[model samples]
Target chain A: MTPGHLRRDAALQTVLWIAVVVVANHLASAIPIRIDATGDQRFTLSQAAHDAVAHLERTLVVTAYFTADLDAPYHEHEAALRDTLDALAVAGAGRIDVQFVDPSTAERAEAAQRAGITPVTYTVRAWDRQEARSVFMGVHVGYGDRQMAVPALLSIPKMEVELVRAIRILTVDPEDRRKVALLQGHGEPNPADYPAQHPLYQLRARLGERYEVVQTVGDAPFDEDIAAVLTLAPTSPMPAATLWHLDQFLMGGGALGFFVASAQPDYQRGTTFEVRHGIGGFLGSYGLALGREVVLDRVHNEKITLPAPGGRSVQVDSPLALTTTHVERTAHAVRSLRSATFPFAAPVVVADPLPEGIQAEVWIRSGPESTARPGPIPLDPRLLVEPAASEVAGPHVLAAVATGTFPSFFQGQPPPGVRADEPLAKGRLGRLLVVGSGDAAANNVDFVLNSVEWLLEDPSLATIRARATGDGPMTPPPAETAWRWKIAVVAPQLLLGLALAWRVRRRRLA
Target chain B: MRNVRAILRRELIGSFGQPIALVALAVFLGAVALFTLWFDDVFVGGVASMRRPFAWMSVCLAVFAPAVTMRAVADERRTGTLHVLATMPVTSFQIIVAKWLAAVILVAIALGLTLTWPLALAWFGDLDPGPVLAGYLGLFLAGSAMAAVGVAASSSTESQVSAFLLAVVATGLPWLVGYALPLVPRPWLGVVNYLTFEYHFANLAVGVLDSRSIVFFASVTALGLRFATHALEQRRLA
Candidate 1:
């Protein structure tokens, strides 16, 4: 063959090979098959996500409003979001439709705003100038007549949780969702105070996704629509009538969750005030009672930043801040948690020789290396040193659950303004979940949501939400150990150089 | 297969017998350690993962890989040995594959030496071995692709310095294009992002061994090797 013809044929082959590679890569991207090797399998779709979309009765459409001209992290996040939506579409087996709309133009931006998708402004550095660019990273899902918007998807790690939750909300029948009441007459922190970081705000938001979260304030009866009642850390004593009404609510088979605190610590005053939230006595009438002491665990605990000298703060592992993995294995609510944190918790004890037909179990407890100090204990970190062997050898109950016919606190004795025959003495079958710490309901919101799901007997999605944990913070090594590790990691580079030099010298000698 | 293996053995010995290979390996390992520890503050971040090290090593291999492959074909061509080898039974494609494999082995060694970080993490904290192993796999694939680009650049040039610079610019473009994503036209954003090295490496770094990303790196390696073979063929035809 002529040299010219040979070169032309070679060029054609090169072009064809390049085209083959491009087409193969493009096809592979569309296939959406991935092997998730992370310990948590974070990249792979969770069972909950698959379940959320698998049995979709009607077509579900997920519309993602993202700006086109995004920079590094945001661009990467958008790509990840697309991949997740593609995975969901594949999981749905043609029931799920995904759409991407670039909301860069003013008209589309306004339309996106109307759809509850908001834009986050980012500062971009252009040629010799810095400009603020507003970009949209919100998602809207539509199923049947209902539509829900994930206002802003700022976190890539939490993208699956957000999308799955929105899908679940949009697809689930409105009539199927139960109602949960949060009692709020006695100075309990408001769950609606989302901006103020009220601990129960997280719980309220999560519950709002699956159930109707309503406030039951000032002698309001627990309506039949209410499947559960949660009284979160009420500081003041609940009215006699309110306590009696709760007893009646429980008698009617409504689940009750009392996240109670025995002592309220005032960080500003450096003192603790004893709280007599009447719910404690009410719970005591059942099989479980909250102890009037603050529990401290030195071994299984979390770190708190305390103000130190020289205008700085140092993080110290505070015993008052408890973290435990000693949760009930059988209960679906707490089983998925690697560890649960209950900061500044009290103790709960099951009353021995319990009432007839009542079955109670302590589902969560502090570590064996723990001490419970009776309130009003001082609020000093220095006073939290390791207790003596006699004082520190108990697994204090941090949370307990009881399910049975609960005998009413106002069984025979009616409260003021109540007729003698008004209250039912023994209630129907009910469930009661009591956590010894109010802070836990907020800090461990997943556990709270899971508990509610377990109470309602729908714990399917609990595991998926729990798996949203990106990665746990590493247990900080001691200063000496950290220094040793840093040296161990960096020193090998020098050793590699030394070995190379020796090899070079040996070769030269040979 | 035997011809490829024989060429691979010769390439490995030829590269390692010189002092530059050892220096390059040491520099690559040291650069990763310094960037991840001091720059990324892996200790302060306190997450038991090899994410930061793999991220920094992607940039390091742009320089390290070219340095390893610069003399593979360019120095032989300059010394007229490539023509002598062309007269032998082995095809230019086998030579290219062998050189690429040798560069990949060097990259593997460099990545393997940095396992101490994960080891210390596992000893002190909770280190997930799956992500670390996936990250090593990702680095190896990305470095192999870059090395193929280096071979292609070397095959086209008689000057080793020119070949190194050419490979550096070619491999460095994909890594640098990630930063310029915002400026890329909206019509071409996805294609431009897909062409980037970090875009494919990002999932693998997080332990998602994505089939698409694997295909991307494989395609890049094939394209590089094919380009090198074509360059050699063109020289012989002339």
Candidate 2:
């Protein structure tokens, strides 16, 4: 060929190669494989997600009502939500249909609201002025006649777990879904009596998404259908017969979660008083004790906004509310908890020389710079005195789980009302999770949800939540220590460059 | 392969013979440290991650890679050494590949200097080696792609400053397009966004070694080397 023809041939080859590359990129994007190099595999979908869609008997239709033109931060969440739904759709094997609708218009917005998807209002600054913009970002899923809505897309990392949870709710068989009993009639916060902002209401509402939350009177025998029992902040003692019934329930291999405090604090009065839920003796049988001491921490604490002497508010880091990142990484219930805070928390200690066949594990603890003292504790955040060097002994156990074949607390004891021909001496295998602070369950929804799932022997959903919780908050080093580290990181490179330059100049001079 | 290695060796030695390369290395290190430590607030954020440092290093390479490659071919052509290189048995492909390879090595050296950041993080807390390795992998890919583009720009221009400017624009437009996605029309949004460097860099930054991102970078590197080779052949024809 001539030189011009050869050049034309070369140019055609280049074009063809570029076309091949473009097509390859398109094909690669179409493939569903993404290697999640994170140690925790945060980006990869959990097995639970795959399983949730793998056996879809009916079409799971998901309608996402999200404004296309949202603020920058919402953009990431929208993309992640779409990606997760797309993955689920692919896993559903033609049983899932996904659609995205912009609910910007009023008619569409009204339709979305009817479907329980609400618009979130955000204020934006543009052209030297601030203006409010209302946007809809919510998901509605339907399987058969059952429907569940993820009210808002607030967290990007949490998007997958929330979507999977909604799908699980829609797909789970009605008979197979477990019932969670909230034992009441002893001054525990009831979901029915509290307002929307109450922690009990929030806890019940969050659990209601996954389980059938039922309020059972504590004075009677629990329904046999109850898979787990949760008792939160019982301010009064249970009846003798009721305690006996609880013991019998445990003897029947039921899972129990106790979130109670030995003392109750009245923040308005700036004082605390000891209160007994009458379960201390009951817990003592299982090798766990409800300590009366209130644990306070100096490190890893949250700031609470309090009314100042003036009309303004002051944010003070209160030791009474302890925030702990020291969670047990191995436990399924607590592994995904980045940090949990316990307000007016007490100690839950395992009995010395734990009972035979009973294995207990501490799931949560206070920071190293913490102290636990017996009540009545002062409720005033400002008036609490600092602990002395001798008093600063902690890393106190705030929560624990014990599992074994528990010996019946009612062993050799007769029935409270009726004479029994035979008294049960031993119980079957059971699990008991105890928390020092009732407020923790009311406050940290994830902790209670995961604990319930652990009790029910269903940890598939917890793994999904763990994938969302990528990493815990870092405890930054002291200022001087960080400065030292910075110098250590920066100095060697500078010095090496200078030394190499000097050596080169010296060789030239030689 | 032998011709490529000989050309690569010559280019590397010629690069280190000058004092400017050392100064450039120092500047890259100082800027990366400043941006990562002070601006990114890695200490304040308190996450045990080298993500911030790697991110700032990627930003630094946008300018640093071009500075390293601006003189790769431009200085030779300006000195009338292109004719000298043409007389050698080495093909234009070998010369361009060798030049690009040398620039990538310098980029790697600059990235290697920041290893102390990860070492410090690991010393302080539980640093997962997976994300750290993924981060370095991503930085190397992005930095090498930028270096390749710089070599192509240098082959087209006779002045170092002109070459640097050309390379910066060529490499930067792709990243800047990501920020302007809001302006892109709905019909062409995906196509335009796919051309952006940020779109691909972000996937790798999150510890996701995605196949699409790898393919995209490889394609960019190949296109850059091809353009540089074509420019060399044009000089031969002239």
TM-scores across all candidates?
0.73, 0.84
lDDT of 2 by residue, A1-510 (tens): 666775776678678878888888888878835788888778877788999899999899999998885654455667788888887888899999999989988899998998899788876543344667788889999999998888788898888888989999889887778999988899788876889998767878888877998888756667889988998888898877667767777777888999988777764655677777788778878888887788888666777655556567677788878888767766767767767889778888889898787889999888766788777666556666667343447888999998888766666484567336434435778889899888788778888889999888899888878667665335455555678778888988988898879877886788
lDDT, model 2: 0.81
Give the clashing pairs for model 1: none
Residue lDDT tens for model 1, B95-149:
8898889998998888777888888767644667787888888888899999999
Give the alpha carbon lDDT tens digit for every residue of B1-238 in model 2: 9999999999988877787678778889989989987777666544566767776887788888898999999999999998899999988889999999999999899988889988877766556777788778888988888998999999998999999999989888887777766556544566776788887887787788988888888989988888888787777776
Per residue, candidate 1 scores C-alpha lDDT tens digits across A1-510 of: 999998998799899999999889879978857888877676788888999998999999889999865764576678779989998999999999899999888899998999999789887654445678788999999998899999899888789989998898888888888888888878788878766366566668778888988898637456878888888888898888788778887877878888888888765565567787767778888888888878888767888666666868788788878787666654657755567788778888898988888898878877666788776655566776747343535688999999888887876566887655654635589888889988788778778888888777677677666456544334345444666667788787778778878877888789
CA lDDT of every candidate: 0.81, 0.81
Write down the RMSD of candidate 2 (Cα, Å). 4.5
